[model samples]
Target: MATVRLLTMLPLWWSLCVSSALTPVRLRTLPLWWSLYISNALTPQALLAEWQAARIKSLDVDASRYHAQVLFVDDDNARARMAESCADALAHWADAGWWIYPHSCSLTEDQALIENPRQEAILTSLGFDGTRVTAAGAALAKEDLDAYDLVICADAAVRDAVLALGEESYETSVRLLADFATVADARSRALFDGLDVALAERARSRQDGGELVVEGADAQSDRDGFDALLESTLVLTAALVVFLKDSFDASFTDSFNGLLRTHFYDERHVDARWADAEPALRRHIVTGALDPRERERLFDAHMTGLRQRLSGDGVSS
Candidate 1:
């Protein structure tokens, strides 16, 4: 009887599976309030792809509306590489069911794309079309300027150029990408570093000019679950230390202070999955505080598992 019931449902299950496989995943077209504008040099395709995938997966939302525009300041040889990287990365993500829309613009109308014959040839050999891969040396149209919720300059020069564009109001949102890209060579870290900035800002906005209040712990505690909660808290603390230190240049003391400040600590606003564990987690994080050297050691010990949990695939583009 069990076998007969299973056989009866087999065809229906197969049909449902086929329908799901054939359906296309639709992504958003407009910019979300959490958009990030990046400088041209930092627009590496692999890095952007990893960031895009991680952000959407971890947050459980379609982050397709977040715009990443590349603004070029000079015709430096390196700009060619940036152009190609951004184009390829955006193209790949678009194909992967992301509504990615990347635009490239120049600081000045007189300047065209970077002119490096050797680099152009190399880029072409690497499957980049010379014509399509070049940065467009044109002023940003009004629509482009309005698309992003925040603008991130990769360096001082990019910041200066953006200021010269006469978007004074947007200046409040302009931040140096370096401030977010603290990790020396890890692009995925840089990406999440930026997300930390965006999320913090978003949380602050929800306060309406006041600090968010965290509710007190419940009266009764689960003694049986205490051991499991403690273990999870330690792991999370280590992962956060790694993120802040490697990606934001935060010192041990500053990292702990910032972690405590994040809205995620607020029991009232935190996700339901973390509600019961937050108070214990906070206590554990505080108790395990260490110096920079010890912090690095803890990070190294748990970095692999942390990334796997936060990013699903551990930062692979």
Candidate 2:
């Protein structure tokens, strides 16, 4: 009877072992869990073998993915029409499969309250949903500038106005609309062609070690600085997806740990790291007016906090 009872429990134990191996942990949470698995397992190699076996038993989806942010800037009724049409073209590209978040803004404050009815009519005729385009006369908020991955200016004046807001850093990729002209002023097709090349290049940049950082903010008088920070944090979440997707094929925890080790845990990549911790950075920066030096300090503090958490336990249980 005792031998039979012991034999009966063996199958149950085997079943549980197999079940644990079959479930693939998401790359985002894999690091902490992998560490804990190592601690409890008979050996690291043994756990790896089990994980490999589990992977063979089922398909595991890679969770690393990123979306691009694109912003269109223009001024005056004529430019607004151009911007709206351009936005519609970008939207079609987005629907086709490019991961993108696109927005349009006016360079002049006075234009923010105006609406572009003509542009709406054109967009509707193109089989585009006019409502998808924000009213033509809206201005780019100072704080919101950091949210864009690409800025398409309708003209030189609009580009200058955007750069005047301290976003000169983005000048590297900011493009002019006139660069691509058609015989019949085929604006939409030309804009789409220019954007296709531009967006493709931008996507390649992520793989080539493009630093993910918020470019700059606008100084809106009525905006609460803290609220602006919070909004900025949200904008970077999509940016983070691009970073993580490109950085690791699978297992964010392992990849991040490897990065920490190689970089010697220094704050060399504060911009990239802080971009990851924008929520906390926003909270820190909002405590006072945003000074240039304040960003470095807040990033350092945030890094310290992250190190503390990692020290106590894995990033996830």
Candidate 3:
């Protein structure tokens, strides 16, 4: 009696499996059957082409709605936080002009916010809502790369980390934030030039060969060195913001590609390429203790100077 019952249930199970495989709606819910069906129905090449088409369509829709969607990645949360604060400072542009959405993440596995007392104090003084700034604990997901119009890395190492997680196709979208500094603009060029000199001097002192090496606070382990690093990151964040605003203003009607160009530092020459500039640049940055109004005033003054220089109207000292 038990054997007969088992035979009867086997036929029913077989029928159900066949039915599930043939039903389109059921296939959508069943991963195993869906994979088999897709494998039998389409070639791998054809499937990839379909996926590419869908991605392009989604990006087109996103572009139509916003001027640009950007993702900023860094080793620590400081750069990410600074990027958010800088974006807030430029919020007025979102009214009728370009709408920029900035997202941030760290390369570390732990998502817990790292403590940066100085950076936190500076941002707090700037009048930005602290609640709005939070960094992701882990690196960005590979599949989520398509969501951003651009993935701007804080430096070459950050860029490399991002690229390693993403496909080769994502290379075009990933770029060094420093690359957008607009070297043609005098103010921006001066900032980067000072950084290069500082980094070069430090690099030369440590090595005998005429090879250029770049070291950070990790190498010097001094309070002033660390402060210089923080100040440089802040300045770069501001400079990139200025560059982005100018790009959008000049190409208000252009496509995302038209508004931005693809630029990266050569792999062999990546050392100290985006490291912080000298402390002199910090004069333009608001960091020390100050009232909110004063902080805002100083921030505005720095941005105004950057804008003027980029626009061909030299800023008067």
Question: Considering every candidate listed, which one attains the maximal lDDT?
Answer: 3
Tens-place lDDT digits, model 2, residues 81-138: 4444444444454241244445566776686656645445534554444555444456
Q: Candidate 3 has what TM-score?
A: 0.44
Error of 1 at 59 (Å): 16
Residue pairs with clashing backbones, model 3: 111-137
Q: Give the alpha-carbon lDDT of every model.
A: 0.35, 0.42, 0.47
Give all candidate RMSDs, comma-separated: 26.6, 24.4, 22.5
Best by TM-score: 3
Off by over 4 Å in 1: 1-87, 90-99, 129-131, 141-143, 148-154, 172-180, 183-317
Per-candidate TM-score against the hidden true structure: 0.32, 0.35, 0.44
> lDDT (0-100) at residue 159 of candidate 2?
65
lDDT of 1 at 235: 24
Per TM-score, what order, best first?
3, 2, 1
